[model samples]
Target: MDWLTFAAFALFAVFSGLGAAFLLRRFGGSSGQWLDALDRLERRIREDLVANREEASKAARGLREEVVGTLKDMAVLQKSTLDGFGAQMGRLTNSLEQRLDAFARQIGDLTKANEMRQEALRATVELRLGQLQEDNAAKLEQMRQTVDEKLQGTLEKRLGESFKLVSERLEQVQKGLGEMQSLANGVGDLKKVLTNVKTRGTWGEVQLGNLLEQILTPDQFMANVACREGSSDRVEYVIRLPGRGEGDGEVWLPIDAKFPREDYERLVEAAERADPEAVEASARALEARIKQSAKDIAGKYVHPPRTTDFAILFLPTEGLYAEVLRRPGLMDALQRDYRVNLCGPTTLGALLNSLQMGFRTLAIQQRSSEVWEILGAVKSEFGKYGEVLDKVQKKLVEASNSIEDISVRRRAIDRKLRGVAALPNDGAKAVLELIEPADVEPD
Candidate 1:
């Protein structure tokens, strides 16, 4: 029994023994039998109590030992868990630090890109403005020369008539000036459009889309594609690479167009003003921007096995594309670090053409495989036809041999008839008797 049950039994025994002893002593005082019975009961109760005590002690000792072992195991488990947790924390800390460093580097590159774009835009604006000024100056000089020539001619001819004509010419000059002002306003509006970052991006996307439409079919490329699983962010375009062999799925090749026009403008402005320090600064900035763009493209779009290992960064304008190429180690760095490919309009067109050719070649190979299978089937059918022809030829030969045997039998019968005829009347009579006729009486 359990400890509680054993204790209950022992308590009852003790109470019963005490009650019986008390009654026996009260009812049978001085009786030897009653005293003996009470003594026996007491002895029995004492023996049971001693046995119960020993069992309880043993059980208690066992329970204590079990609890001590459990505590030791728990302590060991706790230590192991703590060690694992500490190692995990260390790994997490290192990963966090590396991520932070990479993020900081990316931020620095973005800042440089912004600086470069501003410089390039400034330079472009200055150049356009200078050209416009030169054109205006030339027109003014031409007008001045025309006026001087008209004045000289008018002085030698009718002075009043010349002055009236000069006033009309002045009105025409004013009209021309108004037109020039309108042109200048248009240029200002264009500059404003280009200055805005969103407008520039929109323009670049449009240009990229137009080029793609011209070069490839609609099925060949998809626009505004979400490249990653469980992501809402979209890339501008992705080319669909046709799969080779049966059951192989199509692969994606992502293309992102980036126009860092603002930095480019800043660089142009600095160069125009002959500021060596600013130009160098802009150059460095442009380099950083290109690098950052490549890195971003690689991170966002280039997923190996799903997409190509490398992604393309398209620069719409040739000048920007050329500028990126001119940077020392820039292209190599982009390819090595980011798995990014930089392509301008012309180069991208060529690449698309090559891809198209590859697709055509794959199609041809598939078709060839199908044709070979058909040829194999045809060969199998031809073999069956040859077997049928052999069977038919064997039947024809058996029929010919039967016809020859029948002809030989007919000739032997004819010879026997001839022999009977040549034996004279005696032989003919014997033959006739052998083929006896029916009796006349029966008819």
Candidate 2:
């Protein structure tokens, strides 16, 4: 039931009770039960109201306390959460600031290093270019100097040679007549000396000795050397010839000088006078004398196995040599019967040159033998050197392998260093992006 209906019922009950009591009191003045009953009912109502009021007040106070306590707890919890969140934000802020500082430092360092390197590279390039320019300038200067010197030297040498040739020709022309007069006087004196047999022989010997001295060293020729074993048959000159082969003893080659200038002069005079009988007699006499001289030289000097099988008959003058050769069968008879070979100054000179060449060839052969011995020793040592080089090469290869291993490790380390270097920049950028500017304010 509704509270208003209940209240209206109670009020009607109270009024009914009072009216009943009043009527009773008026009807019967001595009826006290109805008054008592009304009082009790009123008292009961009042007590009930009091009790309800007290209970409602107590319940409202309890509800208010509970609400206040809940609000206090909520406030504490929110404060704690906010405090923890603020601490975390502060730590993040400090860390981000530190990372950003490090990143900035790295960037600054990299920029400074780049600038320094660029400056150094530019300086080095300039220095190298300057040096190259200087070197080129020096080389050009040197080449110019060398060319100038060579050209000057060549010109001086050619000029000197040309002047010397011209001077020699002029001097020769000036001396021609004087030289011809001197030669004619000399021929007259030579003819007078030849008139004495002993003086002629001495002159021939001196001429032969001079020729020998021109062609050979002192040790190679001896003058007035005796050749015959029993008799004193001394020769004008004897040349010591080298053996045909190694270890063979040297052989002596005897030479005899026969001028026979008088016979030659008689032949020449007869021929110039155009006297046929005198020319024939003179030529025959010259031929016979030369043949006899060859025989005498062979018999005295041509001793085989000691001296050479043939001896030389030297005609000091070319004209005399030519006359001897012009005699029919004279040279052949001398070679076959007397074992003598004829030679003039020109022919003897050619023979001496050939002998010098032979000596040179023999010396070269001896040097070659020594070189072969040295080469053999060098070859033996070279084989050992080759073995040592092989060992060294093997060691070098081993060292190279070790170096290769170290290089690989170095490469890996370099990569790690590069990765570490990049971390400050990239990580700091990410951290900076996460932090907002407002979040850094103090609560």
Candidate 3:
């Protein structure tokens, strides 16, 4: 397994080969020996005898060194073996002493085991006492568990009663709250109606304004502005229509709020009847009122002084809107004179949203124009600042050049100060400080 073992085996093989080689030299054919001799018959053989002898001597020295090394190794092994024997003898004496120690320990162990047996007996008695104590503790624990269970049952009964009472009270409170909520909703509806009534104009104006406000938008049209110069019948509002008219002027729109409620109620009552003649008469009466109101609005809002392409009659009530639409030839007659736009609450909301978007867009454009002007002014100011900085930089360079030589400037300043010292003190004369003396020299 080791290199030394392999080397020993190899050396033994070499010795055996040497023995075989000697035997072969004695008994082998003479021709083989002659061939071996002829192999050394080169031209350089005789010329390099000293070199060959030196090489042989080196090989002999290496063999001798190997033999000496092997002998030295054998001596080292012998000395180590002797030292190992002495150490083994000393270890044997120590082992014999340890055995004597074991004999004494056996005596101590027997004495200790006897004491341990007595202790074990005492521990057995203590273990029985502990068992008795555990039993007593277990009995006490059982009594405590029984008491805890009884108390838990009593507390659970009280808690369950309290929970049931609280649940009943909560149900009652929820019911009361629901009733209050319903009452609040009714009050809110009433308040909304009153608010609508209060926000509109006078009794007639309030009704009309409320109807129109609910049915039309404020931004798309102007309300209650003068119709014509010195005119008593002021049109309610003028609507600025989308398309431009002739001469690129804005197209006009008419918006009215007046409605006849007496005729409307009569018609509704007549509509529920089976009498055709009565129904026709009531329809005629309602048509007459519609025509009269339309004619009045047209004269006030769609006339020569208040001319408009289209007009609107704001009908706040849904029933009124349906009734107007159902009237045959009524819309045609009104539209023939002036384009009439009839709107209810829903369409009115859409119109208001459109007007809001238009206003917002206009304001944004105006604001952007102002911002552009401000930015342009800022750019101009920044350009002026750049020019001023360049001027300042030139002045700074001139100043720096004037004081380039610090020692010369200091001597010149001292000479000038010595000349100024000869001047009279003029603390009370401010004029002398402002004007230099005419006779002053450059020295």
Candidate 4:
């Protein structure tokens, strides 16, 4: 039994013994019968206590047995459950293994099929590549043969054309050589002509005359002019300038050509020889010759009021002019001392053109008053013209008014004759003849 049941049984036995002892003590002075009854009661109580103890022990043993049986039943149930769960797990594992094997087999089959397809595709590509290469080779060989044949023909044609062109070029070269020989002979003749002093002077004069003729009108300039009074020193050309005053006569601008060919040739030769001393000597000689020529022109041609204060000395060749210009301060010296201006062909052309412009300006200045008078006359005539136009406009207005009056009279006539009916052509003409002649006359 449990501790509580066992303690209750022990307590019952102790109380029974104490109660018997108490009765014996309290009834000691009375009789022995009271003590005997107490004894019997204690014996009965002890018997009951022993009996209760046996029942509690039996109940405890029964309870322990029930608990052990329940535990055994639970252990059996758990074992069965574990067995069922293990079996289910084994079946599931077997099913998964079967499915995985099938899946692996499918994967292997797909891999074989893929490999077979790749091999077939590779074989087909190889066949196609071989066929294509064979076709390309044949085409390339055919193209090469065609190109070779065309190239051969083209080369032959080009070669023939080249030969023909070469022959034509050879003929042109021969012709050019002939022209060059003639040119050389002409150059020799020109050199001979230039060697003479008179011929050189004539050449310079001809060049100067050509430049003047080209730039100036014939009437604008004079040939071989004696610029000074009672002087026989005639200049080659002279351009006439307008006089400064109305009473003053025309001024002359003298241009004379000079060529010191010998000195110029010597300078050219010394430069070509690369001899500094010879070049200096030749240059000085040429400069002296030019200065002497300028002095001669200044003395002979320059006459103030008759001619310009300065005269032009013309150099025919630009090379000679350039050499003269190269002489340091020579142009300034000539202009300051001799009153002579140096001119090449180009410079003389420019000078003549400037003079021509000056002449035109002078002509325009002389005619400006006349032009103004003409404009004044036109202005006066324009006023009279305006008056005449006003009269014509008035006449036109009167005529227009008369035409309107005639239109009204014609309409009235037509209204009166409308009731008379139409007439034949002869009758109409007879009627017109019978009408007043003044009515038919033109206004």
Residue 76 Cα positional deviation in candidate 1, in Å, after optimal superposition: 99
Pick the winner on lDDT between candidates 1 and 2.
1
Each candidate's lDDT (Cα)? Answer: 0.85, 0.85, 0.68, 0.89
Winner on TM-score (2 vs 3): 2
Give the C-alpha miss distance for residue 78 in model 2, angstroms: 99
lDDT (10s digit) by residue, model 1, range 45-76: 77877787777778888989999999999999
Q: List the residue pairs that clash in candidate 3.
A: 224-236
Per-residue CA lDDT of model 3 for 304-344, tens digit only, reads 42456556666656676677778788888767854566655
Q: Tens-digit lDDT track for model 2 on 1-443?
A: 54544665586578667767676766576556666666666777667656765676687689779999999999999999999999999999999999999999999999999999999999999999999999999999999999989988988998898889888887887688678778888888777789887778888788878877887778887887777788698888888887887888878889999988779999999989999999889999999899889988987888878788998999888999998999899999999999888999899878877877776787788699898999999999999999999999999999999999999999999988885645485587696776666778787
| Number of the top-ranking candidate, with lDDT as the measure | 4
In order of TM-score, best first, we have 4, 2, 1, 3
TM-score of each: 0.43, 0.46, 0.34, 0.52
Supply every candidate's count of residue pairs whose N, Cα or C atoms clash at under 3 angstroms: 22, 0, 1, 0
